[model samples]
Target: MMKRYTLMVAGPLVLLGCAGPLTPRDTQQAIRQEVAQAAQPQPAPHAMTDAQAQAALLPPLKLELPKGAAEPAEPRFDLAVNGAPAQDVFMAIVSGTRYSMLVHPEVAGTISANLRNVTVPEAMSAIRELYGYDYTMDGKRIVVRPLTPQTRIFKVNYLAGARVGSSDTRVISGSVSASGTGGASGTTGSGSSQTSLETSKINTTLNSDFWGELKVALETIVGESGKVILSPQSGVVVVRTTPRTMRDVEHFLKATASAVERQVMLEAKILEVQLNDGYQTGINWSVLHNGQHKYSSGANTGNFDLLTGAVSGSLADALGSGLPAAAGTTSGIFGLAFQTKSFAALINFLETQGSVHVLSSPRIAALNNQQAVLKVGTDDFFVTNVSTTSNTGGAGTTTTPSVTLQPFFSGIALDITPQIDEKGRITLHIRPSVSVVTEKIKNIDAGQAGKLTLPLASSAVSETDSVVQVEDGRIVAIGGMMKQSFDDSANRVPGLGRVPLLGYFFGNTSQSSKKSELVILIKPTVIDSQADWQADAEATQARLDKLERQPQTP
Candidate 1:
């Protein structure tokens, strides 16, 4: 009241000091209101406290964008964040996001969120954790707000398939009955038939103990206006209440749902081709002397097979095999790790020294522990079936058949897909088929000779691919090829070769054997950040572009 009087008197003083009225009409009106308010009895303002101030100072979050990066074409993002203010972060995230988002006035504060390049749903979940705020969305905007008693509308789903789903009219179906009688004394026989069918639909609601608790709690908190419904078939709980009730329910769910939740994820990467880098290094050893004994220690770090997850052909391995490995001189595949995280760290380490090559990486989206399939190769072989039929003195005939398998190269194909689980483990699904053909021949009994003929449907299929589940960042090596080639040649005089006593004058013979291995190397990295994911994409793209621009030689 005193401040209002002071302001009322101060406005006129300001006018008196100035040549003209500086206060606008709106200001004059405001002064009049203050004067009127001053005439009425009023209470003093209360001093604000820290907790209250914190709540009042809660601010809207804003997205801290990557300064010079282009927005993704899709709503999904492999987004990651360390520390940033809320007020400046949300809009940038919402703009290109597939789902619309809104922040309520009550939801205010800075958020320390880490997304790990997760999807929109995952990102929102992380944000929700920053503050005790909840979110809801249908086909439109994701609404974020402080859950309270007055807020309504909530949902819950049962694990797996629900026992009850929907409700409709009950069915009344008829039943069927039949009776028959027979006598063995050559008397008469009698029979009677009756048919009927009956079917009845069963209506159900949430019957679990938790469902009862939820209903009772909703009734208590929301009173008569609130409602809680359970769909048996869907195993979903739909509730309507004030924000206050929702807040309580939210707390309940948070406390209880975690115990039954299971989370899995997968990380993947393609091995980048690297030349044998001619790196030269000197070995250094330290000698330790004790009162009675002296010893030397040496160590070197190198080599990892993502396909096998074993430390193979490293300097240590080489030394153990009596051949010391040279530094920075490994062949095969290698690449960069965007950060110090586990997956990235391993990639970075392997790139420095490894003999693995990544041919390609296909873009895939899958849940943890879900399988993805790939088809890579197919081949064909040839076979011949020889048959001998003999007629003995009796009327019965006997037949002998034999099949000769031969190499008839047809084609090579490969198909494989890997599933990733939350623990960074990978389950690889592979299918490699080999198709072969066969020719048939027929020989009559000893009485007559038979001729060879083409057989109907002379093809066969063979499956040789191995399926394995492995740890993320581990290498899996599949090596098995059954194709082979051989050549034998001899040159000399035929008469000289036929002379047994003088067989030493025969010609010389040359034979050659050829064998090949079909090996597929797979490496996985559970991408933990957009940086690492982007690095993998960029590397793959750069290599592809380079290959495309290369000049072809005749």
Candidate 2:
């Protein structure tokens, strides 16, 4: 079984509620009542002082004090005696377990004279200031009480005023003891008495320059005291009084310094990055650059599927395979795994060859707030057919001819338009044009954008084929074309139009043909009409202002 410990800290003893707000007459009455009660003569508790009462309510932690417990020549606090002759005064320094109390006494001819003249209200106020509590007077006794049950140990040291003619006067006196769960540490009465003089000197110095020289002093002390333990949970250093070897002390100090430095650096870096961008901006490069490639190529007749596999594999190896593959190769009814490893390798080679440029840039950085457009060029369509007929009269006659229109290429131009929204979303629109065919014809003139339209039933043309739509504002489309021809007339060589050499037995003939072709054009456009970067800028400023007004905590 594991042992568990929980530290429950008590709150300050200051009471939130007070006697109802007193009127001027009520205040006078209360003061008179207190003074009348203090007028009665009462015996002091055995060797106990008002300082002791205040210290009793605090925690059981020893306070560090100043060096040399000797009294100063002159006190700095006010002193009084029996409501007259405020001359004989002494300064006292008092310390107890977990508390320190100070008192300056006004000397009277006797101790009774001093006690009788002390005003209860003044004493109560002084006690409250030093110990953070309240007090009341009963008859001749001034009863000092904590405003609340909770008490926090505090270390205090102050100088007081001196008496006019007393060198043996006590300048200050105070005491301290464990306030809660006094346990074994409380039993050691001399624990408070055995105050290390050096520790007190260090504490005094620490109070004046807490943020500067104190850090250096802490480092030095930790180095000298090997028994110091750094508590991560409490964010504090616990020092034991036991002696240790110099080497051990140095080791402990070094470890503590390293831990502190690391924590500070980490926190500073987090704050800096947060100011510029979001937390995700700090992601490791390995994740972002994985599976990126530059270039790939293969023979025109080579299997497209195999080439795709090789390229993908190379990419996978170069960028690493932590992520799933985004591209693949396909056979008629089957597919192959084409990871980025192969693709990356090919891209690397091509980059070295200067054939392509691979950015290898962070995807999020490139696309997080950017927009781009892509254009796919135009396409053309064409179709042609030819036939011949001949006639013979008296003697045999024959004719042979051929007409052909070859399709060099067929394509449709696609223009993609892109638009970006406030949240970095993209939309695309596309426009397509008809396919064009260029070939030699038996009887057509050159340098002409030939117009040929085939029969509607035989042509691959439709309204839907003219345009393509993309989810992200991208588009593609195709155009239509058709061609046909026929012979019009044929006759025997009995006519005058047929000469002897050109027409056997004077034969006459004529033929007519029809041709059609389709041309496709693609145009893309981008629109940023709806975007309002000015509004975004204003919102960002407002967010920053709100953050600035928030309260900060340590």
Candidate 3:
């Protein structure tokens, strides 16, 4: 009986422990206690005194302030005065020191200020801000002047010139032609015309009158009492205005200088991708994403647009995730950008899809609002126009033919202009062109002389002009510039190939079509400091060292 009672009691105790310490009634009691405690009144903390707050905000005794050349070189001191003459106060501050104080005849006022452990200039500045006193500092001297106009000269670094840009677009839908008939003895002519549609648009931008615009802006800021004299040739501006207006001018000039002086270093790569048979539609950028490389469009890290790639095709579905599609088309000619540090890695990844060819690698630096161009190739001249002149001579009629040749540029050219803002975003106007030129012979007949031969140029060209905005250090890619070519070839036994009937049986002729895509990648890095230029130089040196290590075949 005893053992049964003990076991029964132990089982109930174990069950209670498993249920936890806080039951429903206990939880409710705890909540009630918390509510009661929160409802009770609480004591407020002590409020700070005026002097305590002042002490908290004041700088320490050894405050290392930037001392201008005009600042007085004397030990700091405390000053407490109540309604004292301004001239006396100034004199008292410089007493026993090498500095001198001069009060203008019109200057008359009473000063009341309390400052501690501050330099003479700091004390004067503090009093000026608190009151409406005007002062100027010379080496070891102070001049108190009445509120009046002041003359200040500002220096601006810019070339003395004007800039102009214009764009024009025109469309004509109809042709203009005239027809005439002539008889042996007399001439008669009849003309007819048809309705034509013509459209014209023109846009012009002028940046030539910078000084004029600046003068107008300054005049508006200073109103009637101010005068602005701009000498663009010398890069100087003289402004006579009130002290308050001068401060505003200083601020405006600072901002303008920073904006105009900014520069960017641009690196570009033009590549040709010959697609493999399986990837004819386009380059499968998903291949890079599925590989060991981590390329994501929506990643929260640095801008990766320099390595423009988008996820597509059935492979992306299998991976369960993909980078967002880039701007422009998904096939042939598309646009992609990436922001990656490794160029070699990107090139290695590209080899999986097709044969890669680097057409051009150009690097240049341009200032804000400046244009840079890079051209690589040759210029060939071909006959474009021909004219014949005849003169009557005693013996016979002499004829002379003149040929006009025009230069055809065959190669790659890139033109780019960059506009950078305070936020480090770059807006670019880019134009890229690629062309291939070949020579063909043209036969022309001269009346008495034999046939005249001239060379004509045959060309295939691809070009695009566009404007885009991107962050600093991001790569911009223009792709899908594709070209198709047909090539013919034959193979046969040397002797059998010449036999007319049997040649067809022995020789094998084949024609193949090739498709290739041109991709241009551009990366612009903002050159904010000397360190950036140093880094670029280091990278160039490293590349040179790497090339020197490679074996050369003589």
lDDT of each: 0.46, 0.29, 0.72
Local accuracy of candidate 1 as per-residue lDDT tens digits, 266-322: 233334323233221111111102222221112222223323434333233444432
lDDT of 2 by residue, 1-554 (tens): 12322222212222325436779657656755554444434554575677887788775797877788765332223333343321222112111112123322322232112223333345445534433443334543333332232222112111122112101101112334332222242121111222122211100000122223323544565455334344333344444332222223445556544322220000000000111112121212122234443212110111112112221223233334442232221111111121232333433322332223221111110121112222223334334443333444356644444444543333322222233344432322222222333433344432473654342112232111111221221111121222233558887745664666766546756786533222222222222222222333343455545665789665
All candidates: CA RMSD (Å)? 28.3, 40.3, 26.2
Preferred candidate (lDDT higher): 1 or 2: 1
The best candidate by TM-score is: 3
| Top candidate by lDDT | 3
Candidate 3 error regions (>4 Å): 1-103, 106-142, 163-216, 219-225, 286-329, 387-403, 441-455
Q: List the candidate 1 regions with Cα displacement exceeding 4 Å.
A: 1-367, 376-419, 429-452, 455-469, 480-484, 490-509, 527-533, 545-551
Better of 1 and 3 by lDDT: 3
TM-score of candidate 3 on Cα atoms, chains taken together: 0.65
Q: How much is the lDDT of residue 38 in candidate 3?
A: 47
Flag the better candidate by TM-score, 1 or 2. 1
Backbone clashes, each candidate: 69, 81, 15
Per-residue lDDT tens digits for candidate 3, residues 208-257, read: 46677778888888899889988999999999887667778889888878
Question: By TM-score, how accurate is candidate 1?
Answer: 0.31
